[model samples]
Target: MFKGSFVALVTPMLASGEIDKDSLQNLVEWHIESGSHGLVAVGTTGESATLPMDEHIEVVKLIVDYAQGRIPVIAGNGANATDEAIFLSQEMAKFAIDGFLSVVPYYNKPQQRGMIAHFEAIASATDLPLLLYNVPSRTVADLKTESVAQLAKHANIVGLKDATGDLNRLAETKAVVDNNFALFSGDDGSGCDYLCQGGHGVISVTANIVPQTMSEMCDAALANDFALAKKLDEKLVGLHKELFVEPNPVMPKWALYKMGKIKDPCLRLPMVLPELNSQKLIEQRLSQLGLIHP
Candidate 1:
């Protein structure tokens, strides 16, 4: 049931590097008002790597609490350790979250069989629907089409967020799985194309800065109006490229701060602010899109 622009929400942080509850709640309200289809809390764009387990769980809970069932909140339950993933899913299942976005096991690089088993175990641990996430660029472990087809058999495993950005995988994976199984593009750049080619939606990073455009684009594509979708997507093409000028939330958070959506653009250690040049580029894109003043 998860479709449209599901923003990989960036967790707003205070100057002290603590979660900004007010900004988090404000973001949730803003997304709902802005017509974003869903929110993926604590995902990679949310800086899941830097957040400790307690903080991770807390963010998901806070998002769920703030959303109040207006929009779906997909918790990022990905962990390299199978048991840790399962535990995170089990814990998040206690909240009102709609599903779990479990990424392919990273760092360790599990085999296809291991990946299947890893996902199956997490799916079995909770009743919430599970969406497989395959962003091999970061995870280093690709979930093969065959493996994804195998995991799609589980009743709780409903969909996948394929970040490989390879559109060919769309037809290839669709050929193997049932039509009802949702395939969401995790890459924002090709998101509209993916939808035009039969993807259900996008788990978008760009949506963090431009929710309305992303939502409208996905809605148009889903409605089979490709011309409108492409038009809307063109407005986001620059944002899609520039937001990744630095690693994920660094640029997104800074964009939000510039737009007055959040207080501090502070990231945890290891993910500092974007370089001055990168900031200038991001600002240029934001200005071009009229998201910020020149």
Candidate 2:
């Protein structure tokens, strides 16, 4: 059910780090109007690591309510603790959220067997389809190919978001997994190639600014129109790289604030605004892409 440009949405917050409820709702509306395929709320780009559980659920609930089934809402239901992950998924499933993007258990660095067990337990916890988020750069514990194939067997374990940026593995992954299992790219830099190589879509950070473009690009790639897809993807190459120049959401949130899309670019402790140099580069790139006026 999850395909196309699902934006890893930025959680709008005030200068005091309070969740900007009105701004958050407005952001959701903007994405839907801009033709984003779906929304992935409170993911790493949304600063999930620092947000308290209560606030995390509140953010998901806000997106779910605001979406009102207009678009799919994939709640970021990942945790290092398997039990916590299961509990959060079960609770969030109570809402109208369409699915869950459960990242690999981070820091703990579980073995492949342990990874299988962790995800299986989560899949059994709720009927909601689970998309395994494997961003090893942040998680440290990579979900190896074998483990992913094993997890794909579970009826509720629907798909995977591979952020490794290794397209070679896609062929091998497709070979073992069921045909129905979706494989999405979590890396925006290689998203077009990933789609060309048979990825269903991307859970994108860049889409926070260029939702319509990203959606169009994914649609073109999925439709086998590589010429148009490449054309669209070329324009987004700068955003895919610079958005991560200062850690996620740091630059993404700032870009939004600069575009006047949000009230404040304020981020939680341990993540501040980008440096002036980084800001200038981002602003120049945005202007070149016509995301904002010069």
Candidate 3:
């Protein structure tokens, strides 16, 4: 049931590095108003790595509350440890979240069989629909198409967010899974192309800045109006590329702050602010889009 521009939301923080509840709630309302289809909280873009378990759970809970059944909320419940992934899934299931975005086990790369086992265990732990996330660039562990097809058999394991940015692989993946199984592009740069190629939706990072454009682009593509979708997507190509000029959420947070959407562009330790050159590049893109003044 989940589809369209599901923003991999960035958790707004105060200058003290604490979660900014007001900013978070405001963002939720803004997305809903902007026509974003769903919210994916505490994912990589949300800086889940820096957030402690308690804070992670808290953010998901808050997003659910703020959404108030108006939009779907998918909790980022992935962990490198199988047990930890299960624990997160179970804990997040207590909230009103629509599903879980569980990443491929990172750091300690697992075999295909191990990955299947890892997701199977998580599926058994909760009835919530689970979306497997394959981001080998960061995880170093690719979730193979065969393994994904295998996991797609589990009722609880309902879909996947493929970040490889390979449209050919998307066709291959679509070939393997049943039509009912959802396939989302985790890569923003190719999101419209992904939809045109038959992806159900996008779990987008760029949507954090231009939720309206992303949502509209997805709508056009889903409606089979590829010309309109391409036109809309062209406006976003700069954001899709530049937001990652530094690591994710750093530039996104800064863009938000510049837009007066948040008070501070605070990030936790080990993930600091973007360099001045990167900031200028991001600002230039934002300005080009008319999202900010030059």
lDDT of each: 0.94, 0.92, 0.93
Give every collision pair in model 3. Answer: none
Candidate 3 lDDT over residue span 1-294, tens digit each: 678999999999999878999999999999999999999999999999989999999999999999999999999988999998888888889998999999998999999999999999998999899999999999999999999999999999889999999988899998999998999999999989999999999999999999999999999999999999999999888889999888888999999999889889999989999999998998888888898996
TM-score of each: 0.99, 0.98, 0.99
Clashes of each: 0, 0, 0
lDDT of 2 by residue, 81-139 (tens): 99899888888999999889999999999999999999999889999999999999998
Q: List residue ranges in candidate 1 displaced over 4 A.
A: none
Off by over 4 Å in 2: none
TM-score, cand. 3 vs. native: 0.99
List RMSD in Å for every model shown.
0.7, 0.8, 0.7
lDDT at position 173, candidate 1: 93
Alpha carbon deviation, residue 286, candidate 2 (Å) = 0.8
lDDT of 1 by residue, 153-194 (tens): 999999999999999999999999988898999999999999
Candidate that scores best on lDDT: 1
Error of 3 at 62 (Å): 0.4
Give the lDDT of residue 70 in candidate 3: 97
